[model samples]
Target chain A: MTEDKFKHEEDLFCSGHRACPGCGAALTSKLVTEATGPQTILSMPTGCMEVTTTPYPESAWGISWIHNIFENSAAVAGGIETAYRSFDKRNKEGYMNHEDVNFVVLAGDGATFDIGIRSLSGMMERGHDVLYICYDNEAYMNTGIQRSSSTPIGAATTTSPAGKESFGEDVHKKDMPSIAAAHGLEYVATASVAYPEDFKKKVEKALEIEGPKYIQIFAPCPRGWRHESKNSIEIARLVVETGLYPIFEMENGKITNVKKLKDRKPVEEYLKVQGRFKHLFEKEGGEEVLEELQKIADSNAEKIGIDKE
Target chain B: MTEDPYEDLKISKGAVVKPRTTLVNKTGSWRSEKPIIDHEKCIACGNCEKFCPDMAVKETEEGKFEIDLEYCKGCGICAEECPVKAIIMEEEEK
Candidate 1:
């Protein structure tokens, strides 16, 4: 039922950037910017994005972009929307008559879930007309793959390095969409770069809504995940097929629909694909870890109503 | 009859806050490590204390923030919020 109504254009993200090969965050950024078109104001935080795209005098962003402190992106974006309104009122009749630009916040998982959560939560609660998208590459990939609250259990990061006495991240990935939905917001959805049509459509839908909207985008981090660039889409597909990252949307705190894969892939197939989970398979009795992960995935699927075909 | 939405806020009703005990330390127990202030790199910006969920970090002599491990969740919010990246989450081996 997937329609190709998407017209892949070239206005926002210019090619030949310094992002690592097969970086999902980069691809998602490109797609998101394109969806919003050139009339967009981006509030980016200090992470892999701010580092890779902008190097001192030169910048990569074509839109009017502001790089705020790591944890204050939502607050900054909210401020930008207000400022735009005031400017348009005094000069061009209130952000309505002129080119209707989208005010968007782009943040990593570290910023969205860990450091900048309060600002994001507050902005969303206040009903700011901004699209808050989280380009989740799992951990804090910008600072060498340190473990953030978004990192899944058994995943290795610089801080949660697998040692003789440790099992990498000890906690499960925090349910961010559920937390966002609990705010009684208009929209909350999950998308991945692997599925561009769905992702683009979701972005479009989010823009059409009046109130605050949130999208937790699953972007693959090749450097942090230790995977080849070509395997990005395949690995992302496995994440959905294994039921780890169920693609679904929540409206008014209730899930309406979920994307179900016809073929259910084993959790091992997903596990062995990423190097971050390499520790889970590199040891004896690794099957136990795999089973535990599968159980978690199954539970998630049940919660989201993702039935196996 | 219209009801107030937050009148039934469960979290603010003096509910007992419990630690994550059911999370079995399959990776062995985490050592209670706290943030040590270098003072040299500390900017006294209060970002660490401002963003700390547990409020375990506090500023002491010379305006440097020190971590109180008792309530610290090892969440590393301080490290992430530190503008200069001064705070590092060091693991204390049990």
Candidate 2:
């Protein structure tokens, strides 16, 4: 239960910030920073999180945070980690200690999957001691809900409207976890805000690892998804329960763990909740798109071997 | 309020002199509604306390939940997710 996960006393993410009501990105950031503790430095790129949390004189983050351009968060984190290592070596007898400082990178899907992939790839290939977290809200939510590479198929957005000619986004969501795994990082995992325990454990585990670690969390956007604010966690849970978003972990290019669904629900149960997919149910020939999406889920289940149990 | 918002930029290249300074900014005016808890019907489930995105709900010394109106954005999430009907959202007073 979520109550069991809230035993910690210090909340690194305090109140009185400007996040929208029931934002999954805000919730995920809270859980992540709480698990990371006080001795951490975060590198955030230009995105919704950076804009909403840090508006001039106010900042929601309690840790040492630096905001960079949209595509260089990974690169900035690498520089920070390198500089900290050098300082730690030079100031062995100094008053300050910088040995156990954690370096993290937080960016949205638009930054990670589309514009910032090159820098991210370079960082992972070099094996920097940085934990990169991409809070996937499925599209460019900060910029008026525009379509991004991470946007799923048959989902409506400002750029990919479901009009007479187009059926929303034509392609599927990019496979980012697998792309990260291909870089042969020490740790890579997928998590959801609905499962706080699992998400916290992954954050803690990533902190323990030595080299580059990547965790992409499935964060739902209420304003962009056109769902009620209170249903954020519920929608996140349904996405996983329907096998649409597989929760898994990898170590050194091999799959180590997968969270299987005991009672898998139909994909329709997950799609019908969000207004982004509302057109699919209303328009003709939309059943084919749903069928295609279901097949993709089934294929994901088969590849992960999650349905065997 | 401080006259110069960029006063900190003169300290160093990228140093954050004052941490957690956001406490000074009062964001309560952003709310359109307010959540009021009925202490008589409260059960201290901690769900409201745990799930508040802003951390506006706190557990009192007597094990009761209290919403900090100064920070609560009237998301109504606490009332919507409350196990019991102890919490209700009323229109914010002008």
Candidate 3:
């Protein structure tokens, strides 16, 4: 019960940001920044985190932060890191010299898996010394809960509503860790907000590596997922336990570790709590979708080795 | 010292020059219900502090914990995750 790994002394991510009451992204930001330290330079894109934390006159970030266009957080970080690398460290007037700071991108899945994939790919391929953290809340949550490429199969959203004629999002969640690992980076990992100790350790590990690294964090949205606000952390844990979100790390294109579910729960324990997956229990063919979703989880457990036994 | 944290940087107009100035927002106003902790039953396991989304649960000088109403958004996460069932959410009186 005493999870001390999540403990940190830094106040880099100050409170009073306008995130929702139980925002997983908000908590994720605090945890990531706690792990990265005060010397970290952050690049964010347009997303719930960017909007909520900057309410015009006030900002929650204590460290240096930059948020430009939607698709180029990684691009900007690459440029900033390149600038930092060439600067004279002895020159006290230099904004920030190399070896003094870690360049990082804190982006949403919409900006990451969809709109910004090209720039992200370019940054990783160019081998920029940076870390990119994607707060994947499953869908384009801030913009009225639109269906994103990262949305899970059978989950209903604004664009992929469940009706008599159609089921929810048909496509599976884009295998983004694999995509990031494909760039030949030293580290690519998946994390959840529920297990913040694991998430924090992953951030620290990614920063220690030389080249570009990607850590996609599962950030559950209370409004988007249609669950009780207080259940945010619990739901995040449930998502992992049900095998819907595999928590693992890849180093040099090989699986290193996986967080196995303490209690392997069925999809219903996870799905029934959220309204987005409500169709899976109500509709006629929804049972089959649940089974199919379970199959995906089983395949993930097999492929990722989340369950060794 | 009342000195601005970002004063040295020449950012443009409307730039946030003060670090953590958002503490003035008092997000506790957003709460429709507030958590009331019964210290008699409190185990002080710090689960509330660990899981607080708003960083509102603070360890008191007595080693027990108390909620900082200034930042608590009344998400009830503390009550939900409380190991001792010491926290009870009470409806706010508007």
lDDT of 3 at A119: 95
Q: Give per-residue lDDT, candidate 1, residue B58.
A: 62
Regions more than 4 Å wrong, model 2: A1-10, A92-98, B1-17, B38-43, B84-86, B91-94
Error of 1 at A83 (Å): 2.4
Query: Against the true structure, what is model 2's DockQ?
Result: 0.32
| Count of clashing residue pairs in every prediction | 2, 0, 0
Tell me the tens digit of each residue's lDDT in model 3 across A1-309. Answer: 233222212368876788899999998988887899989889999999999887776778888888878998999999999888767544647477677799999999999999999999999999999999999998998899999999998989999998996679998889999999989989999999888889999999888889899999998899999999999989988889988899999999999999976567887899999999998898999998999989988888888877745
lDDT of 2 by residue, B1-94 (tens): 7588886665647535345545555567778889999999998888787667777888876777888787777777788778888999899778
Q: Distance (Å) between predicted and true CA of A85, model 1?
A: 3.4
lDDT at position A216, candidate 3? 95
Residue A275 lDDT, candidate 2, scale 0-100: 94
Looking at model 2, the pairs that clash are none
Docking category of candidate 1? incorrect
User: Which number leads on lDDT?
Assistant: 3
Write the candidate numbers in order of decreasing DockQ.
2, 3, 1
DockQ for all models, in order? 0.01, 0.32, 0.32
Q: For model 1, how does the per-residue alpha-carbon lDDT over A1-309 read when each residue is reduced to its tens digit?
A: 133111111225533245564567766777787678778888888888777666554455667777889889999988877777677778855355323878899999999999999999999988888899999988988778899999998888999987786767878889999889888888999987767778888888888887779999888887798876546666777898888899998888888878986666779898897888888888765566678889988888778778765
TM-score of each: 0.72, 0.90, 0.91
